[model samples]
Target: MRAGPLCLLLAVMSMATGAHAEESSPLSLSAGPQIIDLQQRLKESEHQRDELSKQLQNADADRESAQLSRLRQENQRLKLQLKEAQATAPQRLLTDQQQWFVTGGGVAMVALLCGIFASGWRRQRRQWLN
Candidate 1:
C-alpha cells in the first residue's frame, strides 16, 4: 500500500513540472508571424525616411536655383537702368579742341579792333597838325 501511494505522488510531480516548462517557453507558432510583421514595418519606415530625405534635398536645390535666377534678373535690370540714366544725362564740359578754337577766335577779334582804333587815331592827329 505504501508503494502504490509513492508511485501516485511521482506521477503527479512529473505532470506539474511538464506544465511549468510549457508555460515558461515561448510558443513558436505565434512568435514567427509577429517577428516577420515587425521586420516588414521597419523596412517600410526606412524606405519612407529615404524618400522624404530625397524630396527635401530636391526642394532645397530648386529653391537655390530660383533665388539665383531672380538675382540674375535683378542684376540685368540694374544694368539696363544704368544705361538709361547715362543716355538721358546732360553733356559733359567742352573738349580740348573746342576750348582752343574759342580762345583763338576771341584773341583775333581783340587784335583786329585794336588795329582799327590805332589807325583812326593816327589819321586824326595828322589832320589836326596840318
Candidate 2:
C-alpha cells in the first residue's frame, strides 16, 4: 500500500514539472513574430534591389542614345566632307587643263616670232652683200 502511493505521487510531480518547463520556454511564444519580421525584411530588400536595377538600366539606355546621336552626327559630317572633296576634284582637273592650253599657245607664238625675225634678217644681209 505505501509503494503504490509513492508511485502515484512521483507521476503527479513529473507532470507538473513538464508543464512548468513548457510554459517557461520562449521558443513557443516568440518564434512566429521573429519569422514574420525576417520575411518582411527580405521582401523590402528585394524591392529596393529591383528599383536600383531599373535605375541603372535607364541610365545605360540614356548613355547609349547619346552616343548613337553623336556617331550619327559624325557620320553626316564625314559624308559632307567627302562630297566637297569630290566636287573640288573636277574643278582642279579643269584648272590643270587650262594651264596646259595656255602654255602651249604661248610657246607656239614665241616660235613663230623667232622664225619671222630670222627670215627678215637673212634677206637684208643678202641684199646688202649684192
Candidate 3:
C-alpha cells in the first residue's frame, strides 16, 4: 500500500514538470503563417529597392546628357561669335604669290585678246589701212 502511494505521487510530479517544460519549449512556439508572411514582405521590399535604384540611375544619365547638349550648343554659339568678330577685323587680302598669279593671268588674257584682233582674219584690214 505504501509503494502504491509513492508511485502515484511520483507520477503526478512528473506530469506537472512535463507541462511546464512544454510551455517554455522553443519548438512549441506557433507562428507558421506569420513566418511565411514576414519572408514574403521582406522579398517584396528588396524588389522595390532595386527598382528605385534603377530609376535613379536612369534619371542621372538623362540629366547628364541634357547638360552636355546645352554645353555643345553654347560652344557652337561661341564659335559663330568668334568668326563674326574676325570678319570685322582688318585682314591681309592675298599672299605675294597669289598677287603675282592674278596679275599674270590678267596680262595673258589681254595679250590673247590683242592676238585675236591682229590674226589672219584681220590681215586684209591691215593691208587696206597701209
Candidate 4:
C-alpha cells in the first residue's frame, strides 16, 4: 500500500516538471536570430575565399608566363650551341692514335706467324737427317 502511493506521487511530480519545461525551452525565440547570424557569417567567409582564390590564380599566371619565356630563351641558346658543336667537330671512323695501334698489332701478328713457320721447318729438317 505504501509503494503504490509513492509511485503515484512520483508520477504527478514528473508531469508537473514536464509542463514547466515546455514553457521555458529556449528554441522558441532565440534560434531564429542565431541561425540568421551564422548564415551571414558563412556567406562573408565564402565571399572572401573566392576573392583570395582569384588573386592567387592571377599571380600564378604572371609567374608562369615569365618562367615560360625564360625556358624558351634557354632552349634556343642550347640549340645554337649544339649546332655550333656539330658544325665544328670532325666526323671520322677512327682517330690517328687508334689507326697506329691497329697497324702495330697487325705487324706483331705477322711476325709471330713467320717465327713459328721458320722453327717448324728447322725441326723437320733435323728429323729427316736423323
Candidate 5:
C-alpha cells in the first residue's frame, strides 16, 4: 500500500513540473508573410487616416464658404429693406429731425421779442407819453 501511494505522488509531481515548463516557454515565430501583412495593415490605417483628414478639411471649407455666402445674402436683404423703408417713410420726418434745433431757437426768439415789447409798453405808460 505505501509503494502504490508513493508511485501515485511521483506521477502527479511529474505532470505538475511539465505544466510549469510549458507555461514558461516562449511562443515560436511564424516564418511566412505575417510581418509583411502587419506592415500592409499599418500602411492602410495611415492612408485611411490621411483620407479622413482631407475629407474633414474639405467639409470645413465648404461649411465656411456656405456661412460666408449666407451672411452676404442677409446683408443684401437688410440693405434692400433699408432702402424700402427710406422710400416709404414720411418725407417730412427727415426735415423735422434735421431742423428741430432751428425750430426751437425760432420759438425762443419770438417769445423773447414779445416779452421785450410788453415790458417797453408798460414802461412807456408809466412815463406818461403826451
Candidate 6:
C-alpha cells in the first residue's frame, strides 16, 4: 500500500516537471531578440547618463572658476585699500571723547585725594569740648 502511493506521487512529479520544461523552452526561444533589444537600450541609457554627468561637472567647474575670479578681484581691491590706509599718517592714540574721559577721571581722582587729605583732624578740631 505504501509503495502504491509512492509510485503515484513520483509519476505526478515527473509530469509536472516535464510540463514546466516544455513551457520554458518556447519562452527562451522567443526571448533572444527581446534580450538583445534590452541590452542595447541599457547601453544607450548608460551613454546618456555619462554625458549628462560630464555636462554637470563642466557647469560646476565654470561657476566655480567665475566665483574664483571675482574673489581674486575683490582680494586685490582690498589689498590696495589696505596699502592706501597703511601709507597714510599715523593717528592719535586716543580719540577726543576718550581723551576727555581720561581727563575727567584724573580730575575726579585728584578731588577725592584732596577731600581725604583736607578732612584730617586738626589741633583745633580735636578739642571736643570746644
lDDT of each: 0.93, 0.91, 0.91, 0.94, 0.90, 0.92
Model 5, position 29: C-alpha lDDT score: 81
RMSD of each: 19.9, 19.0, 19.2, 7.0, 11.2, 5.7
Clashing pairs in 5: none
lDDT of 6 at 63: 100
lDDT (tens digit, per residue) of candidate 4 on 21-68? 999977767689989999999999999999999999999999999999
TM-score of 1: 0.40
Model 5 segments beyond 4 Å from truth? 1-39, 92-100, 122-130
lDDT by residue for model 2 (1-130), tens: 6999999999999999999999897766758999999999999999999999999999999999999999999999999999999888755544778999989999999999999997875655345555
TM-score for each predicted model, relative to the true structure: 0.40, 0.47, 0.44, 0.57, 0.50, 0.58
In order of listing, the candidates' clash counts read 0, 0, 0, 0, 0, 0
lDDT of 5 at 62: 100
RMSD of model 6, in Å?
Answer: 5.7
Instruction: List the pairs of residues colliding in candidate 3.
Output: none
Instruction: Tell how far residue 84 is off in model 2, in angstroms.
Output: 1.0
Model 5, CA-based lDDT: 0.90
Report the C-alpha lDDT of model 6 over 21-126, residue by residue, as the tens digit: 9888755677889999999999999999999999999999999999999999999999999999988958789999999999999999999989878987454535
- lDDT accuracy of residue 64 in candidate 6: 100
In candidate 1, stretches whose alpha carbon ends up further than 4 angstroms from where it belongs are 1-29, 86-130
Candidate 5 C-alpha lDDT tens digits along 1-130 = 5999999999999999999999998655873478789999999999999999999999999999999999999999999999999999867744666598888889999999999988875654356569
In candidate 5 the C-alpha lDDT for residue 2 amounts to 98
